[model samples]
Target: MELDPKALALFKEGYDKIIEGIKTLGFDVTDENFADTAARAAKGLHELIHDQTQVRKDVDALLAKTFPAKYTEMVISKHNTCFGVCPHHLLPVIYRISMAYIPTEKVLGLSKLSRLARLIARGPRLQEDLTHELADLLHVNLASQGSAVYIEGLHMCMAARGVGAHEARLVTSGVRGVFLELATREEFIKLVVAPPTTLV
Candidate 1:
Protein backbone atom coordinates (compact mmCIF):
# COMPACT_ATOMS: atom_id res chain seq x y z
CA MET A 1 0.00 0.00 0.00
CA GLU A 2 1.03 3.60 -0.64
CA LEU A 3 2.18 5.59 2.40
CA ASP A 4 3.29 9.08 3.24
CA PRO A 5 7.07 9.25 3.16
CA LYS A 6 7.32 11.28 6.37
CA ALA A 7 4.95 9.05 8.26
CA LEU A 8 6.74 5.94 7.04
CA ALA A 9 10.04 7.36 8.23
CA LEU A 10 8.64 8.17 11.65
CA PHE A 11 7.07 4.72 11.90
CA LYS A 12 10.40 3.09 11.12
CA GLU A 13 12.09 5.10 13.84
CA GLY A 14 9.44 4.12 16.36
CA TYR A 15 9.51 0.52 15.17
CA ASP A 16 13.23 0.29 15.68
CA LYS A 17 12.90 1.67 19.18
CA ILE A 18 10.20 -0.86 20.03
CA ILE A 19 12.49 -3.74 19.04
CA GLU A 20 15.42 -2.31 20.95
CA GLY A 21 13.30 -1.49 24.01
CA ILE A 22 11.94 -5.02 24.21
CA LYS A 23 15.45 -6.47 23.78
CA THR A 24 16.68 -4.22 26.60
CA LEU A 25 13.93 -5.59 28.85
CA GLY A 26 15.65 -9.04 28.82
CA PHE A 27 13.45 -10.55 26.07
CA ASP A 28 15.12 -11.76 22.90
CA VAL A 29 13.71 -10.05 19.82
CA THR A 30 14.68 -12.72 17.33
CA ASP A 31 15.22 -12.07 13.63
CA GLU A 32 12.16 -14.15 12.68
CA ASN A 33 9.72 -12.21 14.91
CA PHE A 34 11.44 -8.81 14.83
CA ALA A 35 9.86 -7.39 11.69
CA ASP A 36 6.30 -8.44 12.58
CA THR A 37 6.54 -7.31 16.17
CA ALA A 38 7.95 -3.88 15.26
CA ALA A 39 5.38 -3.39 12.53
CA ARG A 40 2.51 -4.07 14.92
CA ALA A 41 3.89 -1.83 17.62
CA ALA A 42 4.54 1.02 15.19
CA LYS A 43 1.07 0.77 13.67
CA GLY A 44 -0.56 0.87 17.10
CA LEU A 45 1.43 3.88 18.18
CA HIS A 46 0.67 5.76 14.95
CA GLU A 47 -3.04 5.15 15.39
CA LEU A 48 -2.95 6.49 18.92
CA ILE A 49 -1.03 9.64 17.92
CA HIS A 50 -2.48 10.43 14.49
CA ASP A 51 -3.99 13.86 13.81
CA GLN A 52 -7.81 14.08 13.95
CA THR A 53 -8.42 17.34 12.11
CA GLN A 54 -10.12 15.64 9.19
CA VAL A 55 -12.37 13.64 11.47
CA ARG A 56 -13.58 16.81 13.17
CA LYS A 57 -14.35 18.45 9.85
CA ASP A 58 -16.20 15.41 8.59
CA VAL A 59 -18.31 15.12 11.74
CA ASP A 60 -19.19 18.82 11.58
CA ALA A 61 -20.30 18.50 7.97
CA LEU A 62 -22.36 15.43 8.81
CA LEU A 63 -24.05 16.84 11.90
CA ALA A 64 -24.25 20.65 12.25
CA LYS A 65 -27.56 22.20 11.06
CA THR A 66 -29.18 25.61 11.23
CA PHE A 67 -32.79 26.69 10.75
CA PRO A 68 -34.40 30.10 10.42
CA ALA A 69 -35.94 31.98 13.37
CA LYS A 70 -36.53 29.31 16.01
CA TYR A 71 -37.79 29.64 19.57
CA THR A 72 -35.25 29.40 22.36
CA GLU A 73 -35.28 26.49 24.80
CA MET A 74 -32.94 24.25 26.71
CA VAL A 75 -31.57 21.27 24.77
CA ILE A 76 -29.96 18.48 26.72
CA SER A 77 -28.16 15.26 25.80
CA LYS A 78 -27.02 12.69 28.32
CA HIS A 79 -25.05 9.46 28.72
CA ASN A 80 -22.89 9.98 25.64
CA THR A 81 -19.96 7.62 26.07
CA CYS A 82 -16.43 8.47 24.97
CA PHE A 83 -13.45 6.12 24.65
CA GLY A 84 -10.21 8.06 24.41
CA VAL A 85 -6.48 7.57 24.85
CA CYS A 86 -5.00 9.39 27.77
CA PRO A 87 -2.03 11.41 26.47
CA HIS A 88 0.09 10.67 29.53
CA HIS A 89 0.08 6.87 29.51
CA LEU A 90 -1.58 5.98 26.22
CA LEU A 91 -4.26 4.13 28.22
CA PRO A 92 -8.02 4.41 27.72
CA VAL A 93 -10.16 6.96 29.49
CA ILE A 94 -13.84 6.14 29.50
CA TYR A 95 -16.02 9.23 29.48
CA ARG A 96 -19.74 9.81 29.88
CA ILE A 97 -20.82 13.22 28.70
CA SER A 98 -24.04 15.14 29.36
CA MET A 99 -24.65 18.48 27.70
CA ALA A 100 -27.27 21.23 27.56
CA TYR A 101 -27.75 24.25 25.34
CA ILE A 102 -30.25 27.02 24.62
CA PRO A 103 -30.58 27.49 20.90
CA THR A 104 -30.48 30.87 19.25
CA GLU A 105 -31.13 30.17 15.57
CA LYS A 106 -29.59 26.74 15.24
CA VAL A 107 -29.80 23.32 16.83
CA LEU A 108 -28.13 20.00 16.16
CA GLY A 109 -29.87 16.66 15.69
CA LEU A 110 -29.97 14.46 18.78
CA SER A 111 -27.83 11.75 17.21
CA LYS A 112 -25.22 14.27 16.12
CA LEU A 113 -24.46 15.16 19.72
CA SER A 114 -23.32 11.63 20.35
CA ARG A 115 -21.39 11.58 17.09
CA LEU A 116 -19.68 14.82 17.97
CA ALA A 117 -18.77 13.51 21.40
CA ARG A 118 -17.33 10.34 19.92
CA LEU A 119 -15.35 12.08 17.21
CA ILE A 120 -13.74 14.49 19.62
CA ALA A 121 -12.78 11.80 22.12
CA ARG A 122 -10.94 9.44 19.79
CA GLY A 123 -7.31 10.60 19.88
CA PRO A 124 -4.83 11.28 22.69
CA ARG A 125 -6.67 13.74 24.91
CA LEU A 126 -7.29 15.21 28.32
CA GLN A 127 -10.82 15.09 29.76
CA GLU A 128 -10.74 18.78 30.68
CA ASP A 129 -9.66 19.77 27.16
CA LEU A 130 -12.30 17.51 25.68
CA THR A 131 -15.09 19.03 27.78
CA HIS A 132 -14.04 22.61 27.11
CA GLU A 133 -13.63 22.03 23.37
CA LEU A 134 -17.00 20.30 23.07
CA ALA A 135 -18.76 23.13 24.91
CA ASP A 136 -17.02 25.71 22.78
CA LEU A 137 -17.82 23.90 19.55
CA LEU A 138 -21.50 23.62 20.46
CA HIS A 139 -21.75 27.24 21.52
CA VAL A 140 -20.30 28.49 18.25
CA ASN A 141 -21.59 25.96 15.73
CA LEU A 142 -25.13 25.89 17.14
CA ALA A 143 -25.16 29.68 17.48
CA SER A 144 -26.72 29.00 20.84
CA GLN A 145 -27.51 31.39 23.66
CA GLY A 146 -25.58 29.14 26.02
CA SER A 147 -23.93 25.75 26.26
CA ALA A 148 -22.94 23.52 29.13
CA VAL A 149 -20.96 20.27 29.17
CA TYR A 150 -20.42 17.78 31.98
CA ILE A 151 -18.02 14.87 31.79
CA GLU A 152 -17.30 11.95 34.08
CA GLY A 153 -14.26 9.88 33.17
CA LEU A 154 -12.58 6.76 34.45
CA HIS A 155 -8.92 7.22 33.53
CA MET A 156 -7.09 3.97 33.11
CA CYS A 157 -3.82 5.84 33.62
CA MET A 158 -5.00 6.51 37.14
CA ALA A 159 -6.72 3.17 37.65
CA ALA A 160 -3.99 0.97 36.21
CA ARG A 161 -1.07 2.86 37.67
CA GLY A 162 -0.15 5.29 40.44
CA VAL A 163 -2.48 4.72 43.40
CA GLY A 164 -4.48 2.24 41.28
CA ALA A 165 -7.97 2.87 42.55
CA HIS A 166 -10.23 1.54 39.79
CA GLU A 167 -13.41 3.08 41.13
CA ALA A 168 -12.08 6.62 41.11
CA ARG A 169 -13.53 9.00 38.55
CA LEU A 170 -12.92 12.56 37.43
CA VAL A 171 -15.85 14.90 36.79
CA THR A 172 -15.57 18.16 34.91
CA SER A 173 -17.90 20.85 33.58
CA GLY A 174 -17.90 23.86 31.28
CA VAL A 175 -20.56 26.52 30.66
CA ARG A 176 -20.98 29.61 28.56
CA GLY A 177 -23.52 32.45 28.03
CA VAL A 178 -26.96 32.03 29.69
CA PHE A 179 -25.86 28.78 31.28
CA LEU A 180 -23.81 31.03 33.54
CA GLU A 181 -27.05 31.98 35.28
CA LEU A 182 -27.48 30.20 38.60
CA ALA A 183 -30.97 28.87 37.90
CA THR A 184 -30.35 27.99 34.29
CA ARG A 185 -27.19 26.08 35.20
CA GLU A 186 -28.89 24.29 38.09
CA GLU A 187 -31.71 23.18 35.79
CA PHE A 188 -29.19 21.49 33.53
CA ILE A 189 -27.39 19.92 36.47
CA LYS A 190 -30.61 18.54 37.93
CA LEU A 191 -31.59 16.95 34.64
CA VAL A 192 -28.35 14.99 34.42
CA VAL A 193 -28.38 13.92 38.08
CA ALA A 194 -32.08 12.95 38.24
CA PRO A 195 -33.51 9.69 36.98
CA PRO A 196 -35.28 9.52 33.62
CA THR A 197 -38.74 9.33 35.20
CA THR A 198 -38.31 12.85 36.59
CA LEU A 199 -38.13 14.28 33.07
CA VAL A 200 -40.52 11.82 31.46
Candidate 2:
Protein backbone atom coordinates (compact mmCIF):
# COMPACT_ATOMS: atom_id res chain seq x y z
CA MET A 1 0.00 0.00 0.00
CA GLU A 2 1.20 3.49 -0.86
CA LEU A 3 1.89 5.74 2.08
CA ASP A 4 0.92 9.35 2.04
CA PRO A 5 3.92 11.42 1.01
CA LYS A 6 2.84 14.33 3.15
CA ALA A 7 2.59 12.15 6.24
CA LEU A 8 5.99 10.63 5.54
CA ALA A 9 7.52 14.07 5.29
CA LEU A 10 5.96 15.06 8.61
CA PHE A 11 7.26 11.89 10.27
CA LYS A 12 10.76 12.64 9.04
CA GLU A 13 10.48 16.10 10.54
CA GLY A 14 9.44 14.60 13.84
CA TYR A 15 12.36 12.19 13.82
CA ASP A 16 14.73 15.02 13.06
CA LYS A 17 13.45 16.84 16.13
CA ILE A 18 14.04 13.69 18.20
CA ILE A 19 17.62 13.51 16.95
CA GLU A 20 18.12 17.16 17.96
CA GLY A 21 16.71 16.36 21.40
CA ILE A 22 19.21 13.54 21.79
CA LYS A 23 21.99 15.99 20.89
CA THR A 24 21.18 17.95 24.05
CA LEU A 25 22.24 14.86 26.04
CA GLY A 26 25.69 14.97 24.33
CA PHE A 27 24.81 12.39 21.65
CA ASP A 28 26.43 13.36 18.36
CA VAL A 29 23.67 13.10 15.75
CA THR A 30 25.84 14.74 13.09
CA ASP A 31 28.41 11.92 12.92
CA GLU A 32 28.80 10.20 9.53
CA ASN A 33 27.27 7.00 10.96
CA PHE A 34 24.11 8.90 11.93
CA ALA A 35 23.53 10.60 8.55
CA ASP A 36 20.50 8.53 7.54
CA THR A 37 19.36 7.62 11.03
CA ALA A 38 16.47 10.07 11.11
CA ALA A 39 15.13 8.94 7.76
CA ARG A 40 15.38 5.29 8.65
CA ALA A 41 13.74 5.84 12.03
CA ALA A 42 10.90 7.75 10.41
CA LYS A 43 10.29 5.02 7.86
CA GLY A 44 10.40 2.27 10.45
CA LEU A 45 8.03 4.10 12.79
CA HIS A 46 5.59 4.76 9.95
CA GLU A 47 5.51 1.08 9.04
CA LEU A 48 5.06 0.09 12.67
CA ILE A 49 2.02 2.35 12.85
CA HIS A 50 0.58 1.62 9.45
CA ASP A 51 -2.42 3.60 8.24
CA GLN A 52 -5.41 2.68 10.41
CA THR A 53 -7.91 3.20 7.59
CA GLN A 54 -6.01 0.74 5.43
CA VAL A 55 -5.82 -1.70 8.31
CA ARG A 56 -9.56 -1.54 8.79
CA LYS A 57 -10.02 -2.12 5.07
CA ASP A 58 -7.80 -5.16 5.20
CA VAL A 59 -9.75 -6.51 8.18
CA ASP A 60 -13.07 -6.01 6.42
CA ALA A 61 -11.77 -7.87 3.39
CA LEU A 62 -10.67 -10.80 5.51
CA LEU A 63 -13.97 -11.01 7.34
CA ALA A 64 -15.76 -11.01 3.99
CA LYS A 65 -14.20 -14.40 3.20
CA THR A 66 -16.15 -16.37 5.78
CA PHE A 67 -17.64 -19.79 5.02
CA PRO A 68 -20.86 -21.35 6.18
CA ALA A 69 -20.44 -23.60 9.20
CA LYS A 70 -21.90 -27.12 9.00
CA TYR A 71 -22.22 -27.28 12.78
CA THR A 72 -22.31 -24.79 15.61
CA GLU A 73 -19.24 -25.36 17.73
CA MET A 74 -16.62 -23.42 19.58
CA VAL A 75 -13.75 -22.30 17.36
CA ILE A 76 -10.52 -21.39 19.05
CA SER A 77 -7.32 -19.93 17.65
CA LYS A 78 -4.44 -19.79 20.10
CA HIS A 79 -0.94 -18.30 20.35
CA ASN A 80 -1.45 -15.68 17.69
CA THR A 81 1.68 -13.65 18.24
CA CYS A 82 1.32 -9.92 17.61
CA PHE A 83 3.36 -6.76 18.11
CA GLY A 84 2.28 -3.22 18.93
CA VAL A 85 3.63 0.04 20.31
CA CYS A 86 2.60 1.35 23.69
CA PRO A 87 0.93 4.71 23.32
CA HIS A 88 2.19 6.04 26.63
CA HIS A 89 5.89 5.21 26.39
CA LEU A 90 6.21 4.46 22.67
CA LEU A 91 7.80 1.11 23.53
CA PRO A 92 7.14 -2.22 21.86
CA VAL A 93 4.65 -4.70 23.25
CA ILE A 94 4.64 -8.40 22.42
CA TYR A 95 1.31 -10.16 22.53
CA ARG A 96 0.15 -13.74 22.58
CA ILE A 97 -3.55 -13.76 21.80
CA SER A 98 -6.16 -16.50 21.97
CA MET A 99 -9.65 -16.18 20.54
CA ALA A 100 -12.76 -18.31 20.74
CA TYR A 101 -16.18 -18.02 19.21
CA ILE A 102 -19.33 -20.09 18.85
CA PRO A 103 -20.56 -19.74 15.32
CA THR A 104 -24.17 -19.07 14.48
CA GLU A 105 -24.07 -19.68 10.73
CA LYS A 106 -20.77 -18.54 9.25
CA VAL A 107 -17.20 -18.79 10.48
CA LEU A 108 -13.94 -17.12 9.58
CA GLY A 109 -11.14 -19.07 7.90
CA LEU A 110 -8.88 -20.51 10.59
CA SER A 111 -5.79 -18.57 9.55
CA LYS A 112 -7.83 -15.41 9.33
CA LEU A 113 -8.17 -15.46 13.10
CA SER A 114 -4.42 -15.02 13.57
CA ARG A 115 -4.26 -12.46 10.78
CA LEU A 116 -7.06 -10.52 12.39
CA ALA A 117 -5.17 -10.35 15.65
CA ARG A 118 -2.03 -9.08 13.96
CA LEU A 119 -3.89 -6.52 11.90
CA ILE A 120 -5.65 -5.07 14.92
CA ALA A 121 -2.35 -4.93 16.81
CA ARG A 122 -0.33 -3.11 14.15
CA GLY A 123 -0.57 0.26 15.89
CA PRO A 124 -0.23 1.91 19.28
CA ARG A 125 -2.99 0.66 21.61
CA LEU A 126 -3.68 -0.53 25.12
CA GLN A 127 -3.95 -4.26 25.83
CA GLU A 128 -7.34 -3.86 27.43
CA ASP A 129 -8.68 -1.99 24.42
CA LEU A 130 -7.24 -4.51 21.99
CA THR A 131 -8.88 -7.44 23.79
CA HIS A 132 -12.30 -5.84 23.74
CA GLU A 133 -11.94 -4.78 20.11
CA LEU A 134 -11.06 -8.29 18.98
CA ALA A 135 -14.06 -9.80 20.73
CA ASP A 136 -16.35 -7.11 19.35
CA LEU A 137 -15.15 -7.69 15.79
CA LEU A 138 -15.64 -11.46 15.88
CA HIS A 139 -19.02 -11.29 17.58
CA VAL A 140 -20.41 -8.53 15.40
CA ASN A 141 -18.81 -9.18 12.03
CA LEU A 142 -19.39 -12.95 12.00
CA ALA A 143 -22.78 -12.75 13.70
CA SER A 144 -21.48 -15.38 16.08
CA GLN A 145 -23.43 -16.75 19.01
CA GLY A 146 -20.56 -15.60 21.23
CA SER A 147 -16.95 -14.52 21.09
CA ALA A 148 -14.07 -14.21 23.56
CA VAL A 149 -10.55 -12.83 23.32
CA TYR A 150 -7.70 -13.45 25.75
CA ILE A 151 -4.34 -11.74 25.54
CA GLU A 152 -1.06 -11.93 27.43
CA GLY A 153 1.16 -8.93 26.78
CA LEU A 154 4.79 -8.32 27.59
CA HIS A 155 5.22 -4.55 27.61
CA MET A 156 8.63 -2.99 27.13
CA CYS A 157 7.58 0.00 29.20
CA MET A 158 7.26 -2.29 32.18
CA ALA A 159 10.22 -4.55 31.40
CA ALA A 160 12.92 -2.12 30.27
CA ARG A 161 12.03 0.80 32.57
CA GLY A 162 10.12 1.89 35.66
CA VAL A 163 10.62 -0.89 38.22
CA GLY A 164 12.37 -3.01 35.57
CA ALA A 165 10.13 -5.99 36.14
CA HIS A 166 11.26 -7.93 33.10
CA GLU A 167 9.15 -10.97 33.91
CA ALA A 168 5.91 -9.02 34.19
CA ARG A 169 3.09 -9.94 31.86
CA LEU A 170 -0.36 -8.36 31.56
CA VAL A 171 -3.33 -10.60 30.94
CA THR A 172 -6.66 -9.31 29.71
CA SER A 173 -9.88 -10.80 28.36
CA GLY A 174 -13.14 -9.73 26.76
CA VAL A 175 -16.24 -11.82 26.27
CA ARG A 176 -19.63 -11.46 24.66
CA GLY A 177 -22.87 -13.40 24.45
CA VAL A 178 -22.66 -16.96 25.84
CA PHE A 179 -18.99 -16.49 26.55
CA LEU A 180 -20.12 -14.18 29.37
CA GLU A 181 -21.43 -17.25 31.15
CA LEU A 182 -19.22 -18.44 34.00
CA ALA A 183 -18.71 -21.99 32.69
CA THR A 184 -17.94 -20.87 29.17
CA ARG A 185 -15.49 -18.24 30.42
CA GLU A 186 -13.72 -20.76 32.62
CA GLU A 187 -13.40 -23.24 29.75
CA PHE A 188 -11.78 -20.61 27.55
CA ILE A 189 -9.35 -19.59 30.27
CA LYS A 190 -8.47 -23.22 30.99
CA LEU A 191 -7.65 -23.92 27.38
CA VAL A 192 -5.61 -20.71 27.09
CA VAL A 193 -3.41 -21.60 30.07
CA ALA A 194 -3.08 -25.28 29.14
CA PRO A 195 0.21 -26.64 27.86
CA PRO A 196 0.65 -27.09 24.16
CA THR A 197 -0.01 -30.58 22.81
CA THR A 198 3.02 -32.61 21.81
CA LEU A 199 3.65 -32.72 18.11
CA VAL A 200 3.57 -36.10 16.52
Winner by TM-score? 2
- Residue-wise lDDT of candidate 1 within 87-154, one digit each (tens)? 88877788889988898877777788887888788778889999999898888777789999999899
Runs in model 1 lying further than 4 Å from the true structure: 1-16, 27-37, 41-50, 67-71, 194-200
Residue 123 displacement in candidate 1 (angstroms): 2.2
Off by over 4 Å in 2: 195-200
Query: What local lDDT does model 1 show for residue 128?
Result: 93
Q: Tell me the lDDT of candidate 1.
A: 0.79
Global lDDT of each model?
0.79, 0.90
TM-score of 1: 0.78
**TM-score of each candidate?**
0.78, 0.92
